[model samples]
Target chain A: MTLELSTLVAILAMAAATILTRVSGLFLIERVKLSGRARQALEAIPPAVLMAVVAPTALMTGMAETMACAVTALAALRLPLLAATAIGVVCVAVLRAIGL
Target chain B: MTEIIDETNTGQKPDAGGFMDGAKAILPLIAAVLPVGLVYGAVAAGKGLSVLEAALMSALVFAGGSQFVAMDIWTHPASWAGLGFAALLVNVRHVLLSASIGPKMTAFSTPKKYASMLFLADEIWAIAEMKAREARLTPAWFAGVVAPFYASWVLSSVVGAIGGALLGDPALVGLDFAFPAVFIVLIMNFWQGRRTGAVLLASAIAAIGVKSFTGGAWYIAAGALAGLAVAAFASQGEKTENGETVE
Candidate 1:
């Protein structure tokens, strides 16, 4: 019900920082021409970044998380996103429940 | 039924397909994000953030990863400078995301494109990039994904803030894995055989290595850069194999 000044300032600052990160890429894209290795690099960004983001959880978290990640990847190949995710979640929950 | 604003003016009125396609495509992610949002709101509440504050942060900042990091580092008499810097570091990946997707938004006008960048959450960007590979990425479609996802995030956070304490640990049921699970699925979608394998391998090695040592958000940048380097090198190998002279 109440908003404090310091919290508001922090939130606004975070918002500003986020907006800067989001929009700066547009400026970079506008300035750069995509071709050759540059195009390859840009194309790789999606997978590379996604892999980077999830790498820790997939490989380093624990046996349960790693196994669930593998299950999800396998299911993703044949199943819809929702089904694959559900299987992964169920796999991890079961694995965790068993004290993995 | 969200009206899709056709940014590419072919004299087309707002069509339902443009928006509906996007909404349908992002529906799965919405399901995944709901729990995550609830967890975030609960976390914020646990960190002593008021319900209004939690809702405001979710509505304004809108990036989940950085918001979580912010909560981790949150303090009374909050340091705007510290939180702001952390937000930048965690979300620096968006630079690559927006750069990759910017040129693909052929359907968006310059203003519209810039506007859309503000809402470029990871799920939205990943889905949009996938769509662009197979079809045209229209503004209406982008709006459809953003609107529902954004609303769900903010609303869920509000609900969590109000009642998250009663929900107890999300991990007991493995709701926490939803994010990485969804990410794994997206990575599978983006897989392009062995070259992608090389990229992923380099990224995973670098990410794990850096995470083990430095430990923070730097692992993401390190892994992403390593992957990019491998890709650039692989492309160079392709050029040489094709007998194309290197510049």
Candidate 2:
């Protein structure tokens, strides 16, 4: 069901949904007490989401992306962030240059 | 009786200097978000969205994860409900962020507090929380972080949208790799020994598994949920942040 709603409507709906989320945690906390485990899980979520976002792309994409991400991950183990990014970018560039 | 805040917690009220102070504080985050904003613009433009539409999404939605996924799945006759739901799920984390900032923001007038939330991003929230721990977290301090980041986000997206036309292929120039690499660094920071590793590994497995099974980016939220479950289980009797083993 594509274009079931107009673009403006869709955008507005998404924004409203996002704002609801922004306010909900605060709103709920006042009435509902979140257990420590719940808070810990929340703390753990952002990284997991990031992992989810990238892991699949690396899997489905071609060598350039995979290598770039691998280099980034490996470099991440030891190097600072910007340096690791450079290494990843360069690795992918080199791989792509060779027609991989 | 008004609850007492310590002296360190009662610094200058948000003043005219608050805006400038915030602008300066966010310089590093501004630099960090710039490329992401550019890539978002390029990606959205590549999807056939008009420049105005892409910029509008960035300005209005202002959530990077949802925006990226939405753009990825965008097609003619778009699935509006799917986009809305996916964005809602991905941003569910913001519920926690907003709540964490809620007590500190109590100092602000209601309108000021709500207005500040409009531009809240992961980085902005982190900065505000950090400020809160250190001392008084003025709404101005929060706005200071938001100002540069918000400007950088919207403007960089505009530049990338316009540049996308001239640049032909963003992937060829290696812009695509930048975000993944950047995220790798961000993810690495969240690393907390095996506990974190286990959660991340499971989440990645769940994500990749779902991607293979369904071929949908919605796996991101699914995987995140999986990790949350794991973290909840892992939390029982875990070591505290201060290196004290909790029973």
lDDT of 1: 0.85
Runs of candidate 1 with Cα error greater than 4 angstroms are A2-7, B1-25, B69-86, B104-107, B126-141, B239-247
Docking class for candidate 1: medium
What tens digits encode model 2's per-residue C-alpha lDDT throughout A24-90? 7777776787778887788788788888888876777897888778778889999866678778878
Question: Given the true complex, what DockQ would model 2 score?
Answer: 0.51
Binned by DockQ into CAPRI classes (incorrect, acceptable, medium, high), candidate 2 is: medium
TM-score of 2: 0.88
Model 1 DockQ (Cα-based):
0.64
| Clash count in backbone of candidate 2 | 2
Model 2 chain A lowest lDDT segment of ten: A1-10
For model 2, the stretches where C-alpha displacement exceeds 4 angstroms are: A1-5, A77-83, B1-14, B241-247
lDDT of 2 at B28: 72
Worst 10 residues of 2 chain B by lDDT: B1-10
Q: Model 1 chain B — which ten-residue stretch has the worst lDDT?
A: B1-10
